[model samples]
Target: MNQEIQEYNESQTTDIKDVCNRLAQIIDGNLPEAESKIWHRHPVWFLDGNPTVGYSIQKPGVRLMFWSGADFEENGLNVVGKKFKDASIFFQHVSEIHQEDLVRWLNKSKIIQWDYKNIVKRKGELVRLKKS
Candidate 1:
């Protein structure tokens, strides 16, 4: 794990900390080539400079978000963003995380991506970078 991300995970309250740690571990294990760091005050993983996946503590729980998850075609990530391709799921406990689903989503995240790295350059227009 990135030192900054580790510190961020460690800063959370106990239950949330476990969620963060598990999320980080799984994301790192699956996306070993992705660069991870604190982005916008949360831990995000970027693939070739494009944001892929991330997690943050929220009022509801620990939010695990995928930048282009709206098209992941998975039902578990129900909180789809209205303004972007982002989608997320909230986890109140570590046990709530289904490893199989998480792994499947992580795999989908690699093949399905949007051009978030240059969204500003395109005036917020998102173009597909890959497809399932």
Candidate 2:
């Protein structure tokens, strides 16, 4: 566990922390290669040194974002921001988490490489490569 992650988790509300915890468990248990770290103030799960998924505490709720999520199935993803091929799903309560749906995405996420820089510079490059 990361110190930053520990601090962030401790500072959040119980519901928010619970959502974070569940997602962390899903990623950690399913993806042995993925490492949890604090990136841009959020807890991010990295695979092959690239950010695959991350969660942040926002004003509306806890936002779970996938770095190359634009390529992921529409099962539970919501396209977010016009800049990059990023997608997100928001959970207002802990009970809203669908473990199966999230785990499916997590499995798919590891196969895609997220170049945080190129994602902003050349949108969809990662997803395009993943599809090819």
Candidate 3:
């Protein structure tokens, strides 16, 4: 277990911590011995050396980010960055966490390969194509 994540969870309120714990558990349970790491001070779940999901304690609450969020059919998640395919979902309370949806997201996200720089380059190419 990463001490950074433990410390991060410990610093949060009970509700916020619960949401974090549940998200961690969901990812761990779904994946085959998932590897956990602290990236950018946030707890990240990885699959085959690729980042699948991550969670952090933001002022608004626990912010959950998924790497393959753009692959989803509906754009319900807030776009995390224009340069990457990641998306974010905010949870202020444990009760607000939708376990089923999260499970689905993690399951789907684990298989997608995300290359942030390449994605950004490709996006820029598409923009250039459109202007021309």
**C-alpha lDDT score of every prediction, in listed order:** 0.94, 0.78, 0.71
Comparison by TM-score, 1 against 3, better one:
1
TM-score of every model versus the real structure: 0.96, 0.83, 0.77
Give the winner by lDDT: 1 or 2: 1
lDDT of 3 by residue, 1-132 (tens): 467777777777889888887777777777756788788788987765557788888788888888767655445578756665778889988888777887777766755546542445566432211111
- Candidate 1 ranges beyond 4 A from true positions: none
For 68-115, candidate 2 gives per-residue lDDT tens digits of 888775757999667677899999887999988988888778765557
Better of 2 and 3 by TM-score: 2
Clashes of 3: 0
Looking at model 2, residue 10 earns an lDDT score of 77
Candidate 1: residue 127 Cα off by (Å): 0.2
In candidate 1, what are the lDDT values of residues 1-132, reduced to their tens digit? Answer: 999999999999999999999999999999999999999999999999999999988899999999999998888997546779999999999999999999999999999999999999999899999555
Q: How far off is residue 58 in model 1, in Å?
A: 0.7
lDDT of 1 at 98: 92
